[model samples]
Target: MMLSARLLLAATALCCFATTFAISMDGFATGHKCRCLTTTSEVIPTRLFRRIEILAPGPHCGNIEILVTLKSNNVVCVSPDEKWIIELIARISRNRQQKKPEVFSADQHVLK
Candidate 1:
């Protein structure tokens, strides 16, 4: 009788562990799914953009994603292959490179 009880307890524990593992994997798979389903080639003016997010290709997504948030708080996915989009990305990169923070030197410090 004791042996039968031990076997049942072990089986229950194994089943619980398997169930937990399967549930965790389901959440993981859904969370890593790609954000963009369809993209547009239309070029939006830079001034209308409130924010721009560029996500590179990875295991989660096979293509580059360019998500632009407009001033109206709407998000649009733009095609990365578009010529104007490429130019816009290049311009943004150049601007970022040019706007490096200045390093402070001890000699430039002033006592207030």
Candidate 2:
């Protein structure tokens, strides 16, 4: 009976520790919402990029990165060497140009 009591106490202590650890770790998770703590060099693959932006390398003199904004509104960097990524960027730009609303001047020139 004494041994059983000790075992039960140990189990209770372990459960309390686990619960405390979990609660303590929960606060740290929110720190990663921006994810700036992670490596910034990752270039992810995206099927569809809603926007592509080219930024000049600053003091670091690094290669140009294609900032791809995915359909879900998340932004990530992509390499330009990937043919598919380049093609997708071109397609997006073309589609954007085609979707431009034509403006008509007061004179009705249909402002090409």
1-112 per-residue lDDT for model 1 (tens digits): 6999999999999999988887534336656766789999987999999999999988677678989999999999998889999998899899999999988897898669
TM-score to native of every candidate shown = 0.65, 0.41
Each model's number of backbone clashes? 0, 0
What's the lDDT for residue 9 in model 2?
A: 97
Q: Which runs of model 2 end up more than 4 angstroms from their true locations?
A: 1-52, 56-62, 69-75, 109-112
Per-residue CA lDDT of model 2 for 1-112, tens digit only, reads 6999999999999999988887534345442332212223444555565776775654333455666677889776666667766677698789999999988778875436
**Reference-based lDDT, each prediction:** 0.88, 0.64
Q: Judge candidate 1 at residue 67 and give its lDDT.
A: 96
